[model samples]
Target: MLAPPSASPRSVPGLRVPGPRTEPAPGRGARAAYWARLLPLLAALACATRLPSFRWPLWSPDEGYLAVQARMLADGGELYETVVDRKPPLVPWLYAGAFTLFGDDSLLPLKLLALAAQLLTAVLLVSLARRRWGDGAGRTAGVLYLLISVGLNPEDAQAATFEVFMLPCTAAAMWCADRRRWGAAGAAVACAFLAKQTGGAVLLPVGWLLWRGGAARRDTGRLACGLGLPVLAAALLTTPTGFLFWTVTGSGAYASFTGSELHVLVRGLINAALLAAACAGILPPVVRVLRIARTGAAELWLWLASSVAAVLLGFHFFGHYYLQLMPPLALLGAAALQILPRERTVRALVASGCACAVFLAWGLLAPRPELAHATRLAQAVRADTGPRDRVLFWGMHPETYWLADRPPASRYLTAGLLTNYSGGRDGPQVGEKYAVEGAWPVFRREMRRDPPAVVVDDSRGKPFAPDRVPSLRRILSVGYAPVARVEGAVVYVRVGR
Candidate 1:
């Protein structure tokens, strides 16, 4: 009887009932997979496009100064004691490490390291976007991030600045925070801070996310410990007076000379628009997140807010500062890309690729006015000076020291300190009196004790201002003779000494 019942309609061969149906794997479309694989290649190509710039003879003074300091460190000079600058130690330390691994004189290795950091940042952005949004968002975000980073306005984008070195750590911190890895996040944030003082701005958003994610009190404590330990170590290593004076008090004084707040804000907005145009896909996502106000959306908003704060902190809106805003904007842009139809998404991606190619081509072909003169100057200096010789640049240019492979006679790398000391056209009594009175004497004493073999003065073919540093003028007049002129710089060599 049981067998007869089993042979009924349910057991019929052609009319068998179906079991639970399995849905297709999400985002498994051929298009999604193609984009996912293409993202890294695009990012790598973007980085490779900048490689030829490594051989460029001209560089920003800041970059040149950093390179020399790093070389000094690699040559066994102590920080603060022998190498002094207003920047935190991490960047120089990174440079020192690079020099240790590669040749100290060549900029190629340092540039390669920067490119690697840039690529790592793009990868981290993809991981973060994917975890928070989806696969499509991740691929789009990664490609957009690369395009925007390299396509930033030319003013400060080409130089390997502090922001460039700090971005990977900042992106890593955000990725770790997204995953609820509080301790790792804290370490990453600390690394970012070590890279640049303004990098501490990341803490506000990261801390909020930790609290919102219901992290245990003990977990939060671990984060604090992780952050505090490196700071404490750095404090112990660097002299308190020097570190505090330069990074804190002196930094404030430096900020006063940047520019007017209104000027900075207007320039910053223009640069922001250029950045947005480079990756326009971010606009829709930004609008959508504002409308929905979900947790992920709120996190992105916090990131953008914090980035804005960081950019505006000094009221000095260098184009490089806008690099701080790129990660958040790229993520939002990627999300927007994800919302488009598949065909439209492919078209948009192809358009972005074309735009990036154009930007790269333009950057490569643009004329650098400093290149020919700088190369001549470096050649002249190298030809005249021996390996152990020290050179001093009396005016602003720092690139000479790096290019000629000569050590600085004094710790004041740029004329900025002297410029700030001597009241210029900016205003009366606006210069730092302490630097004029206090540091000037030290500079004079240093020059007297260890006078350079060569002194390059950049007064634009005119004598330097006497009021700026009368002692420097006296020293140059006493022992040096004008030897050669290159690129509006008067090169002086010791005559009788």
Candidate 2:
């Protein structure tokens, strides 16, 4: 959460009698237009930081695979039926719909969507900052958010772009709710939920508004309707059979996924550190302190605390997850920036922010080349591997299932080498528990229950001793035989016809 703003004095409701108007300030309109023009250019310039091919291949193997899945879905097929993972349909639906409409799943549409959201978040930040603080603070906030990469990471390509698009809507709506503009608020909340499930969290602050007297009855109803309609749309979108792709399946786990401690630890450590630092930016206070703080602004402390809480829920600490609260948090940061007492402080913060931005850009783009190389694997598998093959990895998808632009059932593998997949031959590496407690047995049950044509794993990292019997190695050694081997990876085909 951005450090909470000190509260403002509550004003008694009143309607002032009409007063005489005064002449406009000398340079007001001109100055406003100049900023308006500069804002767009600055936003457009931000686009350069994210152009396709700029970073090449640093994408996680999973997201890249999603691109491939999106292509398959566009070609007319049930999703997850082929892709074999548990994730909401919104993203795939989004990717497939746009790809189908535009005729490509290139990074362009993703970038474009992210660009629009990024720009909107900036505009909303500018508006909110100006209203809450002053023009100086507003411009400063907008510029900082723009010039820095706190919310925007080119490395992730467009994974968290949903935050950009939906966040502004949520922020604007929350601001409107705070101002008693039910219509605007309703529209904003409704749009955010449609964009991402986590976005519905915006309702938390808006709900606080209702509790805190920030919203009127009419505004509340409008907000309900706005949020309700999108849900109705989703209900309409989901089919009876299309129910398995939830991020968390019916049980308390990641529906039926498993992965190694190494994979989990590597990703988790990096994400946790980043999120911890981001959270550090928001000074923590006890509930009583937040309630009593004279946060010279409206619900500043409350909102900041609430905003941070919003991000932490279901927070895997992924760098992109921070985008959920970043835009609004930017407003808080802007608010925080204004209260800076010294020029030296501002310079220090700004410089540090710039350095972080560079690191973020690298974090995002640096992996692009590796991700791009994984595409080669996809191509090789398609060309050499038989139709009855699945490309498995003891690790993350080199790019993403969707990125391969291939079919869902393409057997583009992601199961862990240590997992109990394929008669327990392939399972998460030896002692890994990251996804097992949540994902394993479900996947094992699925594989033992369903069974793909073959079991293939990269097995690139440290080898795991199969403590479980009926392992793939034993089964394959006795029955299935290795048909192909690439790098440190191996593809095992079930032995006899």
- TM per prediction: 0.84, 0.72
lDDT of 1 by residue, 281-356 (tens): 4464446433432223556667778888998776666777888888877776665455444554576567666666
C-alpha lDDT score of every prediction, in listed order: 0.69, 0.51
Worst 10 residues of 1 by lDDT: 1-10
Give the per-residue lDDT digits (tens) of candidate 2, residues 136-251: 66665565555443433344434534455566677777678767766667667767765555666677767777767746677677778876766566545664243433333432
The pairs that clash in candidate 1 are 282-333
